[model samples]
Target: MYCDESGFTGNDLLDQGSTYFAYASVAINHEEATEYVNNIIQKYKLQGGELKGRNLLKSTKGKKVIAEILSTFKDRIKVGVYHKKFNLACKFYEYIFEPPLSEKSSLFYQIKFHRFISNILYLDFVCRSEEAEKIFSDFQNLMRKKPNYLFSSSETPDMSPLDDIKTFCIHHRDTINQELNSLQGTDIGKWILELSTSALFSILCDWGKEFNQLKVFCDVSKPLKENKELFDVWIGIKDKIYFDFFQGVEEPITFNLSQEVQFVESDKFPGIQIADVAAAACAYAFKEGVNQNTESWIEHIPGMVIGKSVIPDESYTDPNTLDATRNLILLRYLAEKSINKQPLLDGIEEFLSAVTHDLNLNPSNRIATIAENSRSDAPYFNF
Candidate 1:
């Protein structure tokens, strides 16, 4: 499979109206992708650069490029998306850094330790400067259907800025770090980012077991070496980090999650380039209130979509594959994962519980929120 990501930054996770983070994988071979690329180049009549969804989604011709590329790999694509909750970043930050640099707080969260710092971050990130304010204002305007969108809300629409934010953070973590140093070292930001980026592939890992081996190609992102390390750790840590959350699991689920991971410039690899286009299309579909691919986006990923398990021990067996379905019960699947890993979850379940419960994405009603008296010993801090 050729895999590529659209948005993933160390900081933009808190913005609900961002790309959040999205990864797309296609089962098509490089040769096939290459054939499609050639057809697109000829059809579009000359393109010096490789095709990308970001570039293509702009012009009418570009949209066709996205459509054509997706059509070539229809039924072979799988995508995972997230409009990360900023609170989620705090939770992850708290969880990763031992004796967190400072206490973590949310005006909307219950924690009291670092309330001051939390407020500072919010102001700096959301309202600090003119550019930031303008960006945020534009984002708010984009969310016309949802009022006072807190972003982490369970109901309503949001604007996604994950791609831009993530890309920005990757390039400017040091600069942002100087201002937000109270939250442990900037490394926490990077690790949290690793989780979001890698987490996107949980389904891919579950489904790859059906095949003998998997080779993944992705477009280059900032700090190539570090992104490579993050990707590797992400692939290996799933079972280590999430196995205990499952019910029947003893030893972690074992499989060759990936045999080879190659990061190439988008234009250099037609396969990775098309994967980019597919990812962007999924993000557009998701951000536009279309949870799953529809309209011009369904040309890809039209085949069986594997099921997602809400708990820890559950694995995607070959039988779980179903017709292409979006929304794939994302809220429950992620919330349960967060809930089950409570000790490492930064003890902030109020918002987690609210979003997870309100979404009601779980079919079995097995997801027990804190409100339901599902108890844990962690010291939660969300408002």
Candidate 2:
């Protein structure tokens, strides 16, 4: 597979102009990729040293070329797109919640909490909740290892950012709190915070599952190169990276990559160049939506997506959507799976029901007041 990325801001996900990050892997070998690019260039009669996505997006004809390219290669390409802020909120959920909850009830953690909690937190973030901002800020501060930094809850009781979700942390404060306090000092904490790193790992795993012996060629990236050894160890020996968190309750998963990813110049590789176009098209279309001319190219993208779309369709917390109702039901299921923990189970059911019923895209005056009080001194929208 050939890989390339667009809208990569490394660790600076929030401040970047690109609101979405995209990484694409094309399942075409070098010989076929070369022939395809050469044919397209001749057919379009374009001037080019390298068929860069940015340059192709500059003209009407170039866009048509992109459209044709996507139409022809749609089945072979897989693109992962993430809204930067939403992605950050997901990281926050994983870091703060996963450590404790995954340990307690692996089945529930795998089945529900990861998706449900992250979606809930994402809703809180886009709705402009003050607590979401504070939590996100604390996570950023923690990852960056700012001196004398403390979680918001440490200074003020009942003031930590999760709002309703904080109930679980409170119950398991000994374990959860220890993780929060010490995670910044660890390497995994720092690594998990990088969106590119996460996307790369996910997409590679996706490819690995599909093919038995895989060879991945990527555009030159320092971050991927730095993490190469770590990736190999994790992909080669899963137990080395993560405990058998699921155990026999869940089926074993495997990642197969025969050799280390070879980083090469995009100019020399046709496959990486095509992947560049796919990634760029996805990043732009998802971030800004589509115009009249580019809509054809955009239409073909969803089929190529491996999981969720670039932006989620439902406001996860709004009761008007079935998504909220589904989350409520999931909480009840969590209560079922939870072992002999009445208080925690009750808290889960109560918190999710209340939050789902109360939250909306637009907050009420009272909700706004809570938001105003909960936010950090700096504005949440700025990032």
Each prediction's whole-model lDDT (CA): 0.45, 0.65
lDDT of 2 at 232: 77
Report the Cα lDDT for candidate 1. 0.45
Residues 108-152, candidate 1: write the lDDT tens digits: 223222222222223334434443344344333322222332222
Across residues 45-139, which tens digit of lDDT does each residue of candidate 2 receive?
97965778878888998899889989999988988888877677666666666665554555445434555566656666667776666666666
Q: Total backbone clashes of model 2? A: 0
Model 2 alpha-carbon drift over 4 Å, by segment: 45-48, 105-107, 148-151, 154-162, 166-177, 180-187, 234-252, 308-315, 318-383
Q: What TM-score would candidate 1 get against the native? A: 0.50
RMSD of 2: 7.6
lDDT of 2 at 351: 58
Off by over 4 Å in 1: 15-19, 86-189, 194-196, 200-204, 227-254, 257-260, 290-294, 298-383
